[model samples]
Target: MLKIDTVFYNKLLKNFKINIKYAKIKTIHKVIIGRKGKK
Candidate 1:
């Protein structure tokens, strides 16, 4: 049971990390596209 819980926790952490990385990349993409119309 403990091992199962550990595996689940690790998977959750990995997914969280991936989401953060994706968000950062998306923000950078938006900046490059000049979404806000800034000069």
Candidate 2:
């Protein structure tokens, strides 16, 4: 019921946070690679 919903919501939130972190890391890597390619 309510408890289960909270657990599910928490899991989703955690996953969303992890995804955002990974996306940020990926963008940073892309920027570094682009700079390396220029030289």
Candidate 3:
């Protein structure tokens, strides 16, 4: 149904956004820590 599809799509988009935000934060953390140091 259309409603179900919409809900699924919204969930997917929310997950994608979260993933992107996490990736960005991780990259920033790595940059701040430098390559030689342990995470």
lDDT of 1 by residue, 1-39 (tens): 999999999999999999999999999999988966785
lDDT by residue for model 2 (1-39), tens = 999999999999999999999999999999999999999
lDDT accuracy of residue 8 in candidate 1: 100
- Would you list the C-alpha lDDT of every candidate in the order shown? 0.95, 1.00, 0.94
Alpha-carbon lDDT of model 1:
0.95
lDDT of 3 at 29: 89
In model 1, what is the error at residue 5, expressed in angstroms?
0.5
Backbone clashes in candidate 2 total 0
What's the CA RMSD for each of the models?
2.1, 0.3, 3.3
- Which one is best on TM-score? 2
In candidate 2, list every pair of residues with a backbone clash: none
| Candidate 3: tens digits of C-alpha lDDT, residues 1-39 | 999999999999999999999999999988888955755
Runs off by more than 4 Å, candidate 3: 35-39
On lDDT, the candidate that comes out on top is: 2
